[model samples]
Target: MDIFTGLINGFDIALSGTNILFCFLGAVIGTAIGVLPGLGPAATIALLLPITYIIGSPVTAVIMMAGIFYGAMYGGSTTSILLNLPGEAASVVTCIDGYQMAKKGRAGAALGIAAIGSFVAGTVAVLGLTFFAPPLAEFALDFGPPEYFALTTLGLLLAVALSGGSIVKGLIVLVSGLLFAMVGLDPISGKIRFTFGSIGLQGGFDFVTMAMGVFGLGEILYNLESAMKTEIVTTKLGKVFPTLKDWSDSKWPIIRGSVIGFFIGIIPGGGAVISSLASYAIERKYSRHPEEFGNGAIQGVAGPESANNAASSSSFIPLLTLGIPGNAAIAMIFAALMIQGITPGPFLVAEHPDVFWGVIASMYIGNVMLLILNLPMVGLWVQMLRVPYGILAPVIVLFTTVGVYSTQNQVFDVYSMLFFAALGYGMRKLDFDPAPLPLAFVLGPLLERSLRQSLLISGGDLTIFVTRPISGTLIAVLVLLIVGQTVFFLKGRARA
Candidate 1:
């Protein structure tokens, strides 16, 4: 089969000594970060983004970062099971039952199921990427500015729709993210909007800084406030492998999660998080003992863990094929690609088959590595929780400081990170979701660029957006989603 040959070529690239070493290093470091509380893959990648500059080739840099992405997804579940703390957003559902399982002396089985499910999901998702990416890229080539604009709009609407709780709040956060993205230079006129005369402000706030602030520092601050009274679950080393019953119960959830995650991941914005949450919700809704949820259900750990990893893999499709990043981690990869003078788009598959297929192959290798590393080393990961907070806190702060500064070797980034940290902490206190902010910021520039280009091509005619069938259909779906949310909200209020 042609697909088989391409996979062989991919393996040839991934198995090379140089790539293998980097892949292993990425997995090791990613797992380390995943075991630690308060740090997520986005922050870890942001911290390492500067390393790509020294590493040279964008292909290698991206491959390594991709390792970190999936590796962390694999590692985060360890923390969720052992400590009741999720190292990343996607692992939150894992904590619902993973920690409880630990308390009930099934930590090993919970962790094993997570590892196995992630492996299956990740492998299938990469295969999907390998066979489907080129054709998707070809299709995207037919898109015009209007289509892109419509697509971005649809992405934003989807993000809002999936935001859960208070659609108004979700929209507000989404708009705020869009506004934050507008702080930099105007692409059309080369004029600044929100810089306000500060030289540092002219370049705009880095999304990395904002993400670290919101997810990392804010998490630390919240935990610190309650650290004194928090109960830590202790795990008993039981069977390190899943039982026949565990396998039977989890097989369907793993399959369902992978399918759901892959499709959601291709949808442009907040797909990974949404897929994970949706998978967990689905698993719970369909489980025979729904009441056992949040009290050590193995399906909870298996389903969301599978979804998160699958979603991480599928998120790459948009980035590699269309130059559109589906999430923050993918956006950072885009920046690395641009830094290497490599353009990602329709021609990427033909222009750089090695980079394209090689990365895909590396994922397969990385997934296997993660499964091996996560299972046998469960005890080592659990030991990480025993590390003293006083010692760990400073290390995290140091990494955050260095990573932000490394972005452009500017101390201002450090201050910007601190400022956002405070802002993030406040937002958390107010129950304001920060998810939409990064999504909006990343998509804002592209949205503006496409809108202007579409208008230019249409001589100021707005009908250009509706003329394209795909674009029109996407717009209609967005409108329907907004109306549906509104109706649901009004109905709920009326009942109350």
Candidate 2:
């Protein structure tokens, strides 16, 4: 299992006709949604997960899905530049200088630099994945159930802190999700907990249906309540290639952003949005001409775009190596692997080498496809905005409903999905973040299993969680996060 040999085998699978085709399809679909405002990659992936089972192989399904993740990162800049609209949270910073450049008739150049920077960052991230994932997984081989419980507990806490709302509210949502996960039969004991005498509840809630409901249908429903209007900035066609001056100005920012983003993405709750923001802030701090940032600085566009893409790629590390997804997109990926009957963890690289490596290799190919798609196809993506939301929302709902129903071929699953959709919409209207809920649901069973196993191994001693080195360190980190968040919450309330 040398890195080179692993990569070659990965490329062997990735370069296959079927994988390449799916990869290309994913890139195209990811870019399409990225250009269309309001439908982020997480929702798109959740919406698509049901169809993944039909793809026949886990490797191809995951490769296509991974392509969508990073491809959206590459394509999100298109709308940011042309319409001053961010397709996802990570692209928000791009709207600053990117829209300014568009106004100054440098839209094509801005888009070009973004594509180049994304490609470079994404390639670097893939290389990092190749080298870093195996060792991390190997290190994790020594972990026991106590360590797992600690890690998952820490992950849940991090999700609440980063979920972007009242910490109390996030906790409530997290708890609700955990309760929802309790609907099925107990993992350890065969007896059911909360089914309440429903036959469909016996099998528990379908994760795919719930995901589609909460993320896909719920998002669409929430967006429909808002009055969204787009005014596209149409300018004269210009050269799609960046000039030497543009390259000189952007080269260092791209590299710095990539490095910053990769490390940030490794942390729990760290993601493309935060990484891009950090990159923009750092680039501004170090820039010789700091005042040019909000105006039309290429660094503003280059840094954040590169950082977000890099973060998106490296964020896969936690999921692949540790079985913990850092954010909702990666959570969807985790769910996909679970649906494929493949658990991602320390042994993932050893047990499912094809999946682990094929995904990495597909990223390299996907980045190239994105670069090739971004330039000549920019106009095509721009036209996508012209589609009215009035017509679009129903289509999305119809697809989500069909996808959910297709999972069990039962009307009850569809009803369950709509129920969660309503719940998600209600939460959104109340300013409660639903992001943590699905993630919490996905991790709840594993967390419970780990806790039970740890307790049994320790013979009912609670001290085992804090007694082990790895588990102790994780618990310490979790305590610190809770204390910090409590202080922050109190301070905010005092100020308010």
Candidate 3:
């Protein structure tokens, strides 16, 4: 289909009553959760995953779900600028200069830059997705079992590498995720592998329960260790829009961040968090007034905020094109798609253009909605900070428990949730990131399935992964990643 024709059809579908309404609701709910610190997009989406199941249309459900993620990117800057609190991990870099701007009584301008930058960057990313996704999907149509196994292997490794922490620690958790995914019956043999003589175990872990426990409940539990306090920005937000000077200073940063984020977002594991951090570093490097960074530089706020939002938008590209979700939130959306019996991959654009293009079209509308929602209504979101985490935490706990139990009336599912919630809490305290775990869990079975198919095709020959052209390239890339990591690690040890 012609790109223009596809987009027009997409806009037509996106403008329909139901899609528009759900899109708006998703934006509103997403921003609300984002303004309320400690309930980031991933956890919020996990908590709300069941609701999407209740909705009939997969496109509408995804439109809403997608809105929550990028909307959170915009909303996260609210607390970062006003309270010096990062509502999402991706917003952490914004705090360095955003809060400093608030102290300087430029809170409103700081926020204006973030919102405007986010909107521009988001639009750029969607444009990138519009042009890039269809062709990538076309290219991916040729993938066979060998290519798929190799790709999954690379994806799992990239997810671990960019997850930001000790590589060894990430590997350990990654392996654990794969093991946990092996709980049910063997996919090909039809024999149970790890079920401990229990029917529930035979069915394996519930995705919704495990996700709710680890991300939703676990995050709430971890936040209970400290008191929630809002540091009020005393200065009046005199001008909510950036001046011409602020605009001039931020235009280049916004452009650079958009490009940086759109591409980085395509790589597995390099989502909003990494994009924002990378943008900040690049902005600092390019700044003529380097000292101004971390000291109220508008570029600092503009660049990272743009990058994070852009990353959030473009992260959809992989899922929509290659069937690889780049982050936790997108992974949840992937699960949602699976539940709806819609598998996103090379065939998505060709087979389900409505789901593919309607979503792209909705983002254009969603970004406009968010800009309108965030820019003028800054004061409304500020009010969200008043509700303390002490109250919010328990509310989330209660909400997730009910949501999980409703999925399966079994008390064991709730118990399973509680168990993972505790596991999430301990992992948090121990500096082991729980984000990669859920994603790994989701990918594990697919990886195993692909590996099995590839081996079968090659008559159990192990070199098939390196023998096929596309698979060989992917394997070569993985080899480079491993060698690169080893060299980097050795250099770090030597420097120490």
Candidate 4:
């Protein structure tokens, strides 16, 4: 199919009353969650996944989820500038200069630049998705089972290597996630292995249940423990628009951030958080007046905000084209896609063009909605912050519980979510990143299937993984990452 035709048809689908309405709902909800500290896009999508079943259209469900992901990136800067608190982890870099700007009574300028930069970068990323995803999907159609095994193995290892934490801890989490995938029946034998004599365990863990428990309920519990009173900046915001000078200073940073973010977001595990951090480092290194960096530099605010938002947009490419999720949020959406009976991968464009193109197109509309929401209603979002976590926490928990129960109407599912909620909280307290676990869980079955298929083709030879061209290269890269992690681990221990 021609790219323009697919996009046009996508717009036709996206412009419908239902898709548009849900898209707006997702944008509003995503922005709301992003503005509220302790809740990020991944958890919000998990909390809302049950409703997608209710919506019943796979294309619409994915459109809404995509909106939420980028919308969270768009809204995250509000709290950073207004309260010196990061609304989500990706916004932490924004806090450095954003709060300083707010303290200096330039809150309006900082917020304005962030919104504009985000809009530009979001557009740039969507353009990248528009042209690149189709070709990538076409290229992936040639992959064999060995290649798939290598790809999934690489994905799992990348999750550990880029987890932005201790590699050892990431490996432990990765192994734990693989174990979670091992529960239920043995795939080839059709024999139950880990059920431990329970019927519910035979079906294994529902992805939605675990997602809500870990990302949604678990995050809330962890945040409530260390939650503190916060006050929005009291100084007046002079204007809601950036000045000529502000735009002049920010134009180049926004461009640089956009390019950097688009490429970084394509990596399996690197997403908005890492992209934003990388952009900040690059901006700092190249700035003419690096001394002004932590003291309210407009370039500091412009670059990271744009990078995070751009990363959010481009992160969809991997999931839409490669079957591998770009990050944890995309992994949750990948689970939602499966629940809707849609398999994302090379054939997705040919098999479900509506799901593929409608989703990509809806992001364009979502970006506009976010820009409109973030700009004119900046004040409204700040007011939302004043709604104490005391009130917010219970509401979230209630919604999360109800959402999980509604999915399968199974009591077991709710229990599973609560169990994961506890586990998720414990993981956070231990400084263990939960990102690798969900992603690992999502890819585990695929890796197993690929491994089994490759082995069958190679007559049970173990060398099959490294014998094929694509698989061989992927294995080489995987070995390099492992070796690099070893060096990193040793250096950390040496310093300790």
- lDDT winner among the candidates? 3
Q: How close is candidate 3 to the true structure, as a TM-score?
A: 0.98
Tens digits of per-residue lDDT for model 1, 1-496? 2557767887898888888988888888788777776667776776676677778866688789889888888888887888787877788888888888888889899999999999999998998898889788889888888988988788776766775656777788888888888887787898988988888988777777776666667656665665532234456868879999999989999999999988888777656678889999999898889998888888888888899889999989988887777666676676667657787777777787777888899999999999899999878876766677767667777877887788789998889888877877777788887666676777788888999999999999998888789888878888897888889989989999
| Clash count per candidate | 0, 0, 0, 0
lDDT of 2 by residue, 8-115 (tens): 999999999999999999999888888888988989999999888899799999988888888899889988888888987789999999999988899989999998
| lDDT of all predictions | 0.81, 0.89, 0.90, 0.89
| Poorest lDDT segment (10 consecutive residues) of candidate 1 | 226-235
- What's the TM for model 4? 0.98
Ten contiguous residues minimizing lDDT sum, candidate 3: 229-238
Q: Which stretches of candidate 3 lie over 4 Å from their true place?
A: none
TM-score of each: 0.90, 0.97, 0.98, 0.98
Ranked by lDDT, the better of candidates 1 and 4 is 4
On the 0 to 100 scale, the lDDT of residue 384 in model 3 is 78
Spell out the clash pairs found in candidate 3. none
Please state the error at residue 406 of candidate 3 in Å. 1.6
